[model samples]
Target: MELNQIYNNAREKMKGYCKVCPFCDGKACRGEVPGMGGAGTGSAFQANIEAWQRYKLEMRTIHQVQNPSTELELFGVKLTTPIIKAPVTGSSYNMGGSLSEEEYADIVVEGSKEFGTIAMTGDGADPTMYNSGLEAIKQADGFGIAIIKPRSQKEIIKRIKEAEKVGALAVGVDIDGAGLITMALKGQPVGPKSKEEIEELVNSTDLPFILKGIMTLDEARIAAEAGVDAIVVSNHGGRVLDSTPGTADVLAEIVSEVGGRIKILVDGGIRSGVDVLKALALGANGVLVARPLIIGVFGGEKEGFKMILEKMTTELKKAMILTGCESLGAVKGNILRKLND
Candidate 1:
């Protein structure tokens, strides 16, 4: 099954929750909460796509490179490509109840493994949402990452122990979720963490601990100071806050502040390998794809997901070769042309 076929099937299956627009831009479903659109005016969501579009790639073909490597080792885990499956939850409410939480996790973990990468599973308002993801991770021999919400210290620590039991590759807290109304509505207490609170959680995990939802240089520095192994430069896909800057717009600033101090990953409007190239050039060590993968899982399950990954990897390699980047290491800021520049 092709991506288009998968998309069509997903659209039919996920009608109300997600239109599964041809572009997947925020335009079609703006301000749609408990669904696919961004929060508020959806400007934050639209910003992500627009920011990436503004950056042009500089292509150069005159180089002695027979092959280019898309391979990367993130936090000691070998990956075929730098593309990862971003954590997602709430299949019923947010994704149209087409697939159960467990079913979604299964496709994400298994498909990522097949593609030589890892999937990051998410936590949600309901406890079962997290448990199902943990089960899928265990099934995949812990070839996955579990991202917890920014719950209270006790709750977050408790979940970390669970992730440890499952032997997850890493654990993360999307602090951006602190403002999610869904969590509050469900009576699941969640909020932002203090520096001490963040340090405590990082200290509690032997596994690499990541702090997602970092959109500012200060927060990036704080995560680095808190000793997080990595930070996902994200605006919670514009779901948590309205009118926030696109992650891409602020990624370079964050990286400049804490680049080598911590590994940096990013996700937002990243729909293709070209976008992946742009992210790396802007200083991301790796990148994640959410909406497209949702389509892949819903439409084609594991094979469909695998197909999308392979296609992106191929596109990344092509971008690398044409830009004279022989390895992932060679993909640097110079390869991108800023809109202002």
Candidate 2:
């Protein structure tokens, strides 16, 4: 199915929850948390979009770069593109029940595998969220990454064992969800982890461990020092806090501090292939796409999501060619022109 068809279908399914705006920016759904916009004020969500707008690409056609390879080997997995599906949950409340918890999990994991990449499944306030993610990963034959919530060390380690049993490619904790009162109300206490706590978790897993929700240089360094395999430079899609800077705004700073020490991934307002290119230039080993993919599935199921992935990958290839990038590695900060410039 085409993107427009998928969106048109999703727009109807997600009617009141999401407007399914032409651009999926935060302006249309301000202060929407359980329903998909930013948590409060919606500034953080809008910031992610505005930050991308601040940088313009520099066109340079006179070069020997026709087919820039977007391929990358992330944590031993050969990927056709650097795009991974972000872990998302709560279709019932957050998405107007468009898809069942199990359905959303299955589509993302299976779709990413079909597209030659991994999907990161999410843990949420709902008890079935993590379980659904694990089941989906199992069905994919260990092709996906299962992201757990920042529950107690004992709890997280227990889930880690379960993820290992399912043969998941990797595992992670969405520490960004620490502030969700929903989790606490459900009798599952989650909070910030101390460096020592983080170190303990990293040491507990042989599976490549990731710590998502890092937005600052200090936390990036801490994740590196704590021995995380990767750190997702995200503000949890602006769902956790308000007035925070966009992922694009602070990515360069964090990369400058620990660019080579750790694998850096990012997600937030990343709506197109150009945004993906900008992420690589700033120093992301890879990136994630959430809202678009969610809406894709809502609109057209498996094909809908796959179409978005293919379209963005094609766009990234075109972007690489226009900027004279011979490959993913050739994309650098120099290809981007700042608004101030």
Who wins the TM-score comparison?
Answer: 1
Report the Cα RMSD per candidate: 1.0, 1.2
Candidate 1 segments exceeding 4 Å error: none
Going through the candidates in the order shown, the clash numbers are: 0, 0
Point out the worst 10-residue segment of candidate 2 by lDDT: 179-188
What TM-score, to 2 decimals, does candidate 1 have? 0.98
Clash pairs, model 2 backbone: none
Per-residue C-alpha lDDT of model 1 across residues 190-298, encoded as one tens digit per residue = 8889999999999998999999999988888889999999999999899989999888899999989999888999999998999999999999999989998888888
Model 1 scores what on Cα lDDT? 0.91
In order, the Cα lDDT scores of the candidates are: 0.91, 0.90
Candidate 1 shows a clash count of: 0
Model 2 misplaced stretches (Cα beyond 4 Å): 184-187
lDDT tens digits by residue: candidate 2, 171-214: 99989888864576667788999999999999898999999999
